[model samples]
Target chain A: MEKPVVDQAEALRKRAASRRRRRILLYVAAVLAAFYSFWPVMVMGLEGYNIDLGVIIAGEAFKTTTLYIGGLPVNVKAIIPTAYYYLQDLGLEAYPRLVANTLIVAGLSIGLSLAVGIPVAYVLARIEVRGRSLISYLLLALRTMSQFVVIVPLYIAYSRLGLYDTFTGIALAEQLIILAVVVWMLRGFFSDIPRDIYEAATVFGKNEWQVFRRVVFPMVIPGVVVTTMFALVLLWNEFLIADTLTGVATRTAMVGVWEGMSINQLSFNALAWDSLNAAGFLAYIPAIVVVLLIRRYLARGFSLGAAR
Target chain B: MGAETRQGRRARESRRWYLLFIPLFVVVGFVEIYPLIESLYISLTNLNGGASLSNYVTMVTTPTFWNALNISLLYSLSSTILAVLIGIGLTFILTQELKGKGIFEAIYILPLAAAPIVVGVLYSPSSVWDDIQQFFHFILHQPYFNELTPSFYFPVMFFSDAWEWSPLIMLVALSIVNSASKEVYEAAELHGASALQKFRMVTLPAVFRSPVMQFVVVLRFIDAMRAFEVPLAWTNWLGYTNTLGSPVDTISLYLYKLLYSSSLGFPLGVVSAVAVSLFVVTLVGALVLLRLMKAVGG
Candidate 1:
């Protein structure tokens, strides 16, 4: 009996210890995963900031200058430049042109998408159209088709039409992605409006256009905002289309930065790491800020179409 | 007579509503359908513009094309599987009672906002790659840390893609998991089911059985299969030219090479053939995935 009791106690202790061990393992795994996720961003931010700071405080180094802070020697020598200096270093003509082009392309793409997408979404949502499911499936397939697949033909067509190396060309290519997403998202939003609301509007003798313009459109404003924000971010980060479609004249910021980096790579010693990082940082900030500013909408928007 | 007129007017109104679809159809048709048709047509012709099936035959016979297809399959399948697994694991841990989970969630998603080129730059030898290398070499004392090897190339590419995309999967999985009814779990507990048993019987099916989950999977797979930017940036940064049989030469990149940098001059016809073929493959794959998911879910 004593031997059996001892054996039982040992078993219980081992089980408890193993349970504790498992919990520790779980905690460790979580922390490690989080670290892995976050460290890249942290590194990029740090490198980018360091470079930007160095550029901003460009000044002659006072050789042999040192300062003591709590028994630690610190070099108080290197001086950074002003924002103007850094901007000049970032290529005043080219950088500004790239920025303008990026903005224009993104703006035009968004405008065109909204113009095209809103009406289609309304029709799909409110009107009882034949082969509605077929249309939706077609849109899904188009969305799934990689941009690269279409890009080949697009390049040839753009070149043929003299749309190559132009802002409109890039915008048109970007619209391929933007329009589909907008239509899909807005359809979901529009469909969510209770059928009774449409019936009530029709009962009030409101025409189809008026019902859409006055009633359905107003109700889907939140969805519109969410879709717009997401679309803007996507358009801003687009590289493949921009890289292919645009030449020197219409090169967007993404393409410009890439080319600049590659050019800099050839002369590694004289490479403007600061300028490169600054450009990268500049490129990255808008999307991050936009996303964070409208994070709530994004969270809701992401869950809206699919989850429903 | 008044009710008949109202019904006629409603019919007219619905017909007019169809007009609203015209602009969208025109735009999409011009951009998507036209290009697709143009690609198909181009693929069926020779460089001399003569109609022929020679382009498709050439693509089939080309070793580079086969190599690219193999690499694409390897990269997409491996990356998708790993990312989904990691995403599932992260979702499981995240859904548990943990402190500061929100911060982790936010951090996990930060990569999604970054451009692929930016990601490549961050991981390239000129930047944090060296730091990562040193961490392995000096800290871990594992010398001979060569990142140029195929082993390094595959994993780095996989990790980079996964880093950007896994968060999306996590979000989707979490949404599904959280939305699962608590009553099921309570019932399982009442039945004296163990934690693992309850999770297997309840949580797994709850998350995986959703149609939305399958949609997300197919979408991610398509994206993975066509991955270009990250690999391009990495190889560009390293000045590494991807030849035939190169591990990193995804089909899209291979197509790009043919279009822009082919030694036999611009093989537009062959590239177009490859594009059309890939498009068909992706569509069929997506359909098959949908069917499989439906079968499993049911």
Candidate 2:
């Protein structure tokens, strides 16, 4: 056999060139990703600074730094904090009530869904029932149904049944979203426990309930916590149902923000960008904190707990 | 006799487990099924206060209804596809060996915390669009693009949705990509596979063929179809729109108008018919997708 000659320097040069290209690509991608992810948030926060291009264009006075690039003026305002004033304009009482309503509704939703969902999820996971896939598909179908489809009828039903405009009503209506998630996630988590452990525990003369309590429940406590947090996010941010169902007393933070937008629109003849941005940023605080807290479990949660 | 009794006892024990599903069914039945049945009944009722298919006739005959249907499909399809594409890109970048990966990942996930209303408010014409308009005006000497046009409205909606949701897809895909063995890629390289060949044979299959990614994709698609918040926030829940089925109106928005803001009255029957139709459409879409997922996954 003829021996082939190797061009070592050329190979090294080619590899280095490829690595350089990759490195450049990585840098570009990272920057784009950063800009794409955070631009909206940055815009929201920066709008709060009350940056006025007109002021810079006019070359006005009072705590303004103007930068000229390509003969275009960029005015960087001195942290005017207009958002705070707008929040103040939103009034103090409404904000607190909105927060309380959101919290109460969220609390009730989480408690109810978990109480009802855990048992269903556990049974579906461990038992091979004939109606298993049917139940699952039903849940998935409900999840996919448009909020308007269900909420319209629920609106009429709640109005007639005296459930309208109550905290309990809002909480109950939220179950349409929360229960599906709770069951789907908990089922995924419950199934994660190997069947061998379950079988071994059963072989030790433990009943199905005992096996669940001692073994399965203990194993998926982390999952339960994550599910609770996820449900809380869903409830806190829920708009359409809460917006329609809630009256003045039960107005959630999200509804409050919408009301703020309408108020600004009607009065000011302009969208209250600064105040609305401020309100939105304020409203998202709890969700952000909770999401960060459960960041590690997010891969599973985002997949509806289908992925591990 | 002992063996028969023992078998009967085991069957009884297993049957007891079905009782656990009672609470779930009760809540779902009262909350969901009752309303669904009521909607069906209402949809069958006519405008003249009698039982007929008049609402279904209206739904099928209205041109604006068809337009709303088209807009809904376009919005949902574009947003879902964009979300997956961007998510795949983010996943690729994120999985590479890079500095500050953790921080980048955290930044990416920040959008998920944003409420839909907030996303809508953030992307409204007077805010981000104005900024973008100024940018185009300054940089390219382009005139301010009218927001009412479909060209502008659709892209803004798509981008806003993709921004808010792609992180979720990214996270799921990242997990899948991370869980895959590195040796597979190395083996492909050893086999003298080109970079494109290696990616096609290795990375694409590892991520797309997984059931989890498929689930996430379908989930996004289905969720996107329910596009409500952005359209509502942009228009102030039709506070600004003069007519039903405006340019920005998705099917959900159109349905809301039919139910709440009709010129004649609450067209309850027609709205209910639309809701029932939507229910059927979403269910069928979901079933078809799940079937497709299984086929592809296998």
- The DockQ figures for the candidates are 0.41, 0.54
**Docking band of candidate 2:** medium
| Local accuracy by lDDT, each model | 0.73, 0.78
In angstroms and one decimal each, the interface RMSD of every candidate reads 4.9, 3.0
Per-residue lDDT for B1-298 in model 2, tens only?
9999999987887788778888888888877888888888889998677889988998889887888888888888899899888887887788676899988988889899988878887787666666676667666678767776657767888889998999988888878877889899889889998655766678878889887888878878778778777776555633555467577777887886676566735478888888888888889866855564344331
* Residue A35 accuracy (lDDT) in model 1: 86
Q: lDDT of candidate 2 vs native? A: 0.78
Residue B282 CA error for candidate 2 (Å)? 1.0
TM-score of chain A of each: 0.74, 0.83
- After best superposition, candidate 2 residue B171: deviation in angstroms? 1.8
lDDT of 2 at B207: 84
DockQ for candidate 2, please give it: 0.54
